[model samples]
Target: MTRKASGAPGQDGHDDLQRNLTNRHIQLIAIGGAIGTGLFMGSGKTISLAGPSIVFVYMAIGIMLFFVMRAMGELLLSNLQYRSFIDFSADLLGPWAGFFTGWTYWFCWIVTGIADVIAITGYAQFWFPDIPQWLPAIACVLVLLGLNLLTVKLFGETEFWFAMIKIVAIVTLIGVGLCMVFSGFVSPAGRQASLANLWNDGGMFPNGLMGFFAGFQIAVFAFVGIELVGTTAAEAKDPERTLPRAINSIPVRIIVFYVLALVAIMAVTPWRDVVPGKSPFVELFVLAGLPAAAGVINFVVLTSAASSANSGVFSTSRMLYGLSLKGDAPKSFGTLSSRSVPSRGLMFSCICLLAGAFLMWMIPDLMEAFTLVTTVSAILFMFVWSLILLSYIAYRRQRAALHQASRFKMPGGVPMCVACLAFFAGILVLLTLKDDTRQALIVTPLWFVLLGVAYQFVRRRAVAGVVAIQ
Candidate 1:
């Protein structure tokens, strides 16, 4: 297999995106991707729904996705020409696979970006109650857009700091919560913090089997951007060394960031007492009698949302740039600015992000709108992940020699890929068990239908151009 050029030349003589993202940038970006806004904001609801069982729900999802990432790592390293999963899906499958996978992944980030924008407005309200929600929503979009427009390295630097803030906050929460639990710290509610709180109430399965299943709906959103490292392959300084290091660390990050963090929160505050509408991270601080720290946690959560929105902006633009190179999107999106940033695609994504602000104004109940968009984002992301697995399956069958030669081969091989696909199918069924997610699930197919129609038009135009040239 021949490697394709990483980038095309622009009129300004910039050949491609400079390989400026160092090992540290890729590592932190992977960490940031693993830890998402959903964990901080949505964990409270998950606890209320699944009780202590929610811990298992997170672990289950994390384990399955680790395999998915392993498969992606193997595929990516098999041929460095493959910039992201989008390219591999196209190469292993048909052109239609690339079209659907690329566009859907682009839409996945856009929808998730909108959710982050909505989350940002709500977080801003924590500091400025009287400010219009749209003010912060639109403000976040512009700020991230400006940073992204500067350079890809700037995007990496911004995410590095943003992810660092999240890391510090989670570690502090876990540390503080453990201290409270060990000391038998008593809360204002006259309840003592203890590890026994995990099952002292209604036991681990407090909400029963159905409630455990419901946890997947929102919990899946927490893992939305876990595969974001794949998008940085082109900009990464050392693809062979950096990509695997980033992918291999995912399981450890999930355990520390999601599993242990949630355990600490539940142990400190008990699943029964956890409020569905509030953030457990902030609530745990207040419960520990540190009002000032709670305020600080709110600021951290706000930055987490901003970081996710920034990532969405960067990945969506790159996806569009890739799609345009394949002639699946407009040619202008294939061009880069003087700084080698995909400015056109970046602006287009920002404009779509503004729709979140518009939704805030249009819908009187913001959480309701947030729930709708988040479910849609989760569904679309599952499609992208599924495509990655499918591509791996194709690679194993068609490129057996590549698989045998891979230094970073996926574990369990093709069988694990099939199992991951089955697991995602189960999640889709779980989505329908709830009213809100069910609606989003039903509406998701329409997106693919639209993509199917658009793909035909793109193909026809390409064919006509070839004939005219001949």
Candidate 2:
């Protein structure tokens, strides 16, 4: 089950700094990455905007993404040679593929980090209505820095607890929602609500084909950090066993947390009553006669936001570390500290996060900044997912003879990967509508332009260094 490392770790002056992240930490961190605070808060808007059709949107995207993960899983399980998806891209495509994959991924995490910080301020406003939003945002940034700076296991354990809060909250919600659906819980309106509400409003596809498609556009955002589980492969205790087990559960988790949860919600409350500005989750427990529901949800959601931002830091830092090792990033970032953590890379990302927070704070128009940041992140994540699939296709093409001899193989093979790309391209086209999602479309391309510029700089340095040596 032990596969060899693809390349020896680059001597970053602190080889001992690598952390021993335990299985528990990785498990919870994977779960934490999957649970976005946006789902807790933003789902109401999606429901309101798309109605019952949102359920289908979640399911469709889930199926497509599950295939994407399966491809990654089979590839990673096949050989321990690849570190991150970037390494796989390099091995499958070329060294330049690694450069683009690594940087795009780094940007993906950075943008996600910005969004998480925005979500923190937005979530904080629920409790501290009077406090200037930036204060809590600043404090949370500092808190994230201090927490991550200690050690990887601590970060993992910390994310484990954060993810747990969100997980428990979600399970409780699904349970309560089911009770209301079957047992007839009396709502705030003094009337009984039940399963009939789901279809009675207009059936599951009330939004029509377009509505269903629109739902996918918004729903895809909930699945943004899902790739984080694969990124942890390099640090896994026994990746061959743990990676497959962890990944195999994604479809179930996605269905339970997203699809079923959405079904239960619209079933109880109807799609129209769901609002975009507030959480239907909080409203649900309140409707179910729990006065302290707001308090309980607040605590859960606070952790959800923190968990996302925390994972953002972890993922981005690790990506940079991986990039540094591949000769794509500044050598300083490759330095792992004494705690076995990538101290320099970790600090670099945290500093960038704080800078991101300041930009949003200074803007004053929080909504615009939040939208631009998140949409860009979603687009970048899609790019990364696309690359992973492309890498798989390349892996199969190059290693056909070898793979034929291996046991772990990607199901549906080339066709599945091609379909995933088509699905992503459709999402890209959907991004052009100048409403809630248009900013993402605009900014996402700009990000690539920036990456292209940086790619040139790195390529030149790499060429010059080789020439001088010769």
The 10 consecutive residues of candidate 2 with the worst lDDT sum are 1-10
What does candidate 2 score on TM? 0.93
Candidate 2 lDDT over residue span 218-318, tens digit each? 66778888888887777676676677666777778888888788877777887878778878998888887888999888888878878888888888877
The CA lDDT at 238 in model 1 is: 87
Question: RMSD for each model, in Å, please?
Answer: 3.2, 3.6
lDDT of 1 at 407: 97
Candidate 1's displacement at residue 393, Å, is 0.3
Q: Which candidate is the best by TM-score?
A: 1
For model 1, residues 341-424, the per-residue Cα lDDT tens digits are 888899999998897568556888767778988999999999999999999999999999988889999999899999999999
lDDT of 1: 0.89
In order of appearance, the predictions have TM-scores of: 0.96, 0.93
